[model samples]
Target: MKKEIIIKHLGVVLLLNGVFLFISFLISFFLNESSTVALLFSALICGIFGVFPLIFVERTEHISFNEGLTIVVLGWIITCVVGMLPYLMWGGEFTLTNAWFESVSGFTTTGSTILTEIESLPKGILFWRSSTHWIGGIGVILFVLLILPRSKGQRITIYNTEISSLSKMNFRYNTRKIVHILAVVYISLTLLETIALMVFGMNFFDAINHSFATIATGGFSTKNLSIAEYNNLGIEVIIMVFMILSGNHFGLIYGTIMLKKENLFRSSLARTFVSVLLIGVLLVTLKLYLSGTYDLLTSLRYASFQVISLGTTTGFATVDTIHWPIFTQIILIYFTIQCAMSGSTSGGLKFDRVYIFFKLLGKQIKLLKHPNSVFVSKFDGKRIDEKLEEQTLVFIVLYVAVFFATTIILTAMDIDGMTAFSASIATLGNVGPGFENVSSLGNFASLPDFGKFVLSVNMLLGRLEIFNILALIMIKK
Candidate 1:
């Protein structure tokens, strides 16, 4: 299976992580923080391991599908392992399980955390944490693809493995161009958000970190109260704008910026996604206001933020939604399951699939009424073939089964039904905060170690998109 080629590519992933770790180390070193040595040591470990393989293995221009898949899967597992090193060594709230959970959550951009006192951590550690989101937001393998000076075949192989077919639906470019589009859109959004935050009186460090979290849709906050700590309407408005943008397809964003044909306004999927989010906001805001939860403006503020936050799978909280009305919570839960667009940073059961699911359902209903009629399902004006349609349906079923299985496993751990169910979907959707014990503004510190571990696996499954891991397993068998 071209094991050497796999190792070489995986080494690149580690090296990329090592670079971020070193940046974190420098932050700790300059600040004389407690995590300095830990960050430094972790960075060194990544560098040494990363370099050794590159030194020994000759670079190959071509990689098999199995090798590419192995590299992509193992690359994430390895990165997560190394990611926990700083937390494990720093040792404040980080036990072994806690470190692993935090690492998985970070790289998966799940935003779920084990820290009870997030503000107590060193700046370097916090930066490293946010860095994980940025690195993983676009994907570690995609970063490697950008740097790898390989042939088109090599790039395409890894690209196919790293990105899903659904994500590539709107991207009309070749492999290199597609990767470049993602990088450009990703970096531009991050920089723009950072500047906006700083202009609104956020300090540079916090601004950049929050930008990393926002553009990545990763939801990790520098403060304990998340965006609520700022309490600035301007800041909230800026983040909400970016959060919505980040949730849309990056290619569409690029196209819109470049005045291309496949822009967000031209894409039906993008329009529907936005419409659904607005509808969610309206429903939640109306309920909050009518229930006397808050005045109209106040209700609109919190409801819009939470709705968009969870809708995009960003998970940042402007309010503690646990105290909200049940109808509002259910609406939020629906958004958690129906996450953002496919090509964006946010993960989980993407809104595109949900859109397609409904379309397919309508097609089936029409067929029942007219037995001889042929019904064709299409998305964004493109025909959906039977094969892709079957695959999407299978994916949805698998997604449901996996989350339900996780819920069962968590319940077996003796967690409350609400916590277990919400946590299951939350982690599986990579949507961070859930209701009950793991609600918005609450940490995962109270969960059993095994439960945290299970959720960590859920985050990985969500990030890997179910099929990749299953394909890898089949390859092994």
Candidate 2:
């Protein structure tokens, strides 16, 4: 492995983060907030470390697969480390573990937080938190790739490592084009959402922050009650629409906007994804209404927002779902486990895998009935190769095993069964808010430090995709 190449690429990642940190510092400086010095020092540290590599190591036109993987993995780890600096320096409820947990949650777009009083944070700190989502939403490495001029080989190598095979399914373009599509869609959505939120009475700062969280599907709300604080139906409706859009395949979204043949309406996967979300909404809404939790309209309103939020893995909550009926909770849990589509910002056992799993199951049953019959599974008119099928099944099993292992570990720490189980899946799925102690309205501050650490690892695993990390390990061995 070319260690220098890895360092050089990783430097770019740091510089990208440094740029955001500087912006955050400006926010603090302008507001004369307490975090100004901390943000400035953190940004300087990132700049010094980031620039040191470029000055010493000459740029390379290419990097090997292993080098690319190392850069991608290390980029995230290092980014998280640097991400925690401002928080640690600013001080407050941020202990060492709490800072690490919040940083990981933000970068992973997991949205799980350990802070008990979120509203007390400085505006600069809050913007930095949301900035982490926007940065990590498309991916840190991809941003680096965008600015790395003429390094096609390096770009493709790192792009492949950063993006999953499933995510690439809808992206017919080459690496550069795919990266551009992601940036365009990501930026455009953030801008449009910011405008919409502003139109609905949110201040400029709040609008941009929420837009960042919403577009990234990372639910770090400025208010303690999240979207509930607004109490504006228009804001909720706008967020819900963007959440669902953010959860779909970005390539398909780009296609739809470009009026291409493979637009959202034309893709079966996209159609089914929306359909499933609607069905979940219907089920949860009915349960909420029938159980007298709310009137029909009220139930639909709250239920639709909650279902879409968790269904998209955005984690922005309109209501405290912990008090809802067990049936409704179960439905939400299902969405938590079966997260958003593959190519979108949301993570975990992607809906594509779940969609394929059932399709493959049906195919197997059909083959069983007719012993010699040939059965091939397909999605969106594309054939699912046998190897890809095997890989997806293995990934699902491994994903399940990892979460189960986490749940066991959490439970062993004396955490309750519901909290442990829900926290495990929620983190592993990068869906944020769990039940019980970590309910939609509740934070993860109550968990022991070690328990928070374990969930943070889960967040990274989900964000990186289990296979990527495991493959990197295998390569190391």
- Per-residue lDDT of model 2, residues 320-427, tens digit only: 988999999999999999998877888788888888789899998998899798888877667877876787899899999999999999999999999999999999
TM-score for each of the candidates: 0.96, 0.96
In the range 168-260, model 1's lDDT, one tens digit per residue, is 666776668878888888999999999999999999999999999999889999999999999999999999999999999888899899998
CA displacement after TM-score superposition, residue 454 of candidate 1 (Å): 0.6
lDDT of each: 0.88, 0.88
Cα RMSD (angstroms) for every candidate in the order listed: 2.0, 2.1
